[model samples]
Target: MVRLTPAQLWRFVKRFEARVLIGLVLATGALWTFLNLAEEMSEGEIDAVDRRLILMLRNPADPSDPIGSRNVEEAVRDITALGGTALVVVITVVSVLAFLFHKKRIHALVMAGAVLAAWASSDLSKMLYGRPRPDLVPHEAYVYSASFPSGHSTMSTAAFLTLAMLVASLEPRRRSKALAYVLAALVVVGVGFSRVYLGVHWPSDVLGGWCLGALWALVGWIVLRALHAPTRGS
Candidate 1:
């Protein structure tokens, strides 16, 4: 094994330190966005824009009916289900098992903890915000809680993105990492859009959820990287 000189070792430590700094910046930005949205929502400043955005997806003649065909509406509902509590739980369980199978115990723990924390945080934030569901259009899907930050968007983004990072870590190729993140982004975007399309959540709600969930997932990934640092080389 080639021994790393003092200069090279210093450079390695600095690189990881820079990564940690970037992670902190990203987390701060996400939390700031969520708080700003919550404040605006509480002041009712975002309601008009939320209603207008929701209405854009509905027919002028009928706010109850989404502009898409029945098939598309059904498809949207199915897509939204992927972010529902049941589906998120199932996916998380499977992912944890897969990580364990690969002997990645730390990854599995982080994955489970990050998603559950995001899910709980989403619920708590919803209750704290107590923002009502959009009244601008009829809901195309069932909803049970307050709608400031969409639970589906939050949980799905947390779970799916964390899962993506776990899978990407197993590969040492840039293409694999890019593909994993791309797929997770697609899922997050789709679920967020579906929430708005169904009129169960305001656009701002989805935005807040995405921000919060991404924050938690990024944190988990950063922690994993730090824990695995000893095994890393320049």
Candidate 2:
């Protein structure tokens, strides 16, 4: 049996890790480009697909009627609340405080900054697009903001995914890291879907939000990793 030297092992590990990071960077870039293209094409117009998808959740006979029963509507509202501004703020604050308590100041700061950036970006996009919320069906949830990009979708994706990345970084086991990412993906998808089901956001709006939010989260993760890297003199 041949034994590999420390230098050889280190080089192999570095190559593997680099490949993973490069993949993430490419995925983020691709999503951002796709979002820009979508915005350019659909800028003052609602696509037929977006209109049909939103309407599918409504009764054909009565456009105002939500497809589900009262219980389902209530359940959807509760799910949507998970991505609401109030809840996202609370979760981000609690996570930051916990990170600070553990003396991980960099992580805490990155998480807070990422979420704030996501919120600001969402607002700016809404202002730039000035797209109105869906009026085809009565909204199942309260909304007062312009709806080009779903704030709930963006904020929830940024917050949950940022937290997931932080947690996954701390896990020494690969399986644990995978689970963290899986849970993050579930939360992001669920929150985005809730917006459409509630009849307050078009499907395209949610897609744009998801793309933006995921890009933000990945950028934050990259920044945090760079910040935490060891100095050469050390």
Candidate 3:
């Protein structure tokens, strides 16, 4: 019989609990504060920043105008248009299709569940706060939604990040895995920034979206891991 060294045995044992414990502790604490911090200083600061960000994110009326806002507006327009949505939709469809065809029902279920959950959370927050989008800038687009927290930002982050996590787990090589994570991060960040650049979302709205999205994604990951862990062992 082959013998296992103490160090190797210890490493395997440590993997069983250490990472999970650390991830849970940190994620729980951060999400708790993100959800709870309602003190005057924090809320006031968030409000102020949100207002300032809206002002800063607005596009200049003239494309030729010399300003720091030109690039931002272009980026926003490019991303807020159907092109961005198309890209995201394609990615989501592809992922779901792949999972379904491959018979990975669990993956498909989690992806769908996470997206819906994130959107629901975002809509609930909007209704609860009933905050309107900034009116300082001339409305570039037809605006009808409650805009305390950006739903696009939140949902996009949740979906792309979750996809990234799943891809990272499935990929075989370190380089490929890292690339997947980076691309996922870029998608989430790009979507959030696109909302701000469109003048549809206050900076605070995007911030809250990221916080909520990340927290939701983390919770989903934990649940998915728990569900899969036993299957892997079996």
Task: Score candidate 3 by TM-score against the native.
Answer: 0.76
- Top model number, lDDT: 1
Candidate-wise lDDT, in order: 0.88, 0.81, 0.66
Rank list by TM-score = 1, 2, 3
| Minimal lDDT window, size 10, model 1 | 225-234
The positional error of residue 31 in candidate 1, measured at the CA in angstroms, is 0.7
Cα error of candidate 3 at position 215, Å: 1.7
Q: How many pairs of residues in model 3 come into backbone collision?
A: 0
Q: Please, what is the TM-score per model?
A: 0.91, 0.84, 0.76
Number of clashes in model 2? 0
lDDT of 2 by residue, 1-234 (tens): 989999978765664366358747765784776467466635645577788898888889988888889998888888888888999999999999998898888888879998998899889988877888887888888899998788999899899999988887777788888898999898889889889988899888888888778777877777666565321111
Clashing pairs in 1: none
In angstroms, give how far residue 101 of model 2 lies from its true place. Answer: 0.9
lDDT, residue 200, model 2:
93
Q: Ten consecutive residues with minimal summed lDDT in candidate 3? A: 225-234
User: What shift in Å separates residue 161 of candidate 1 from its native position after superposition?
Assistant: 1.1
Every model: Cα RMSD to truth: 4.3, 6.8, 6.6
Per-residue lDDT of model 1, residues 1-234, tens digit only: 899999989876865677677887888898999999899889989888998999999999989999879999999999999899999999999988987887789988989999989988998998898988988877888888999899989998999898887777777777878898999999999999999999999999999999989989988878877776322221
Off by over 4 Å in 2: 1-24, 27-31, 37-46, 229-234
Model 3 off-target regions past 4 Å?
1-16, 37-45, 58-74, 81-90, 229-234
Residues 6-99 of candidate 3: C-alpha lDDT, one tens digit per residue: 9978775665465556657756874675466323223555767666666655434742232356575576666655223356567667887897
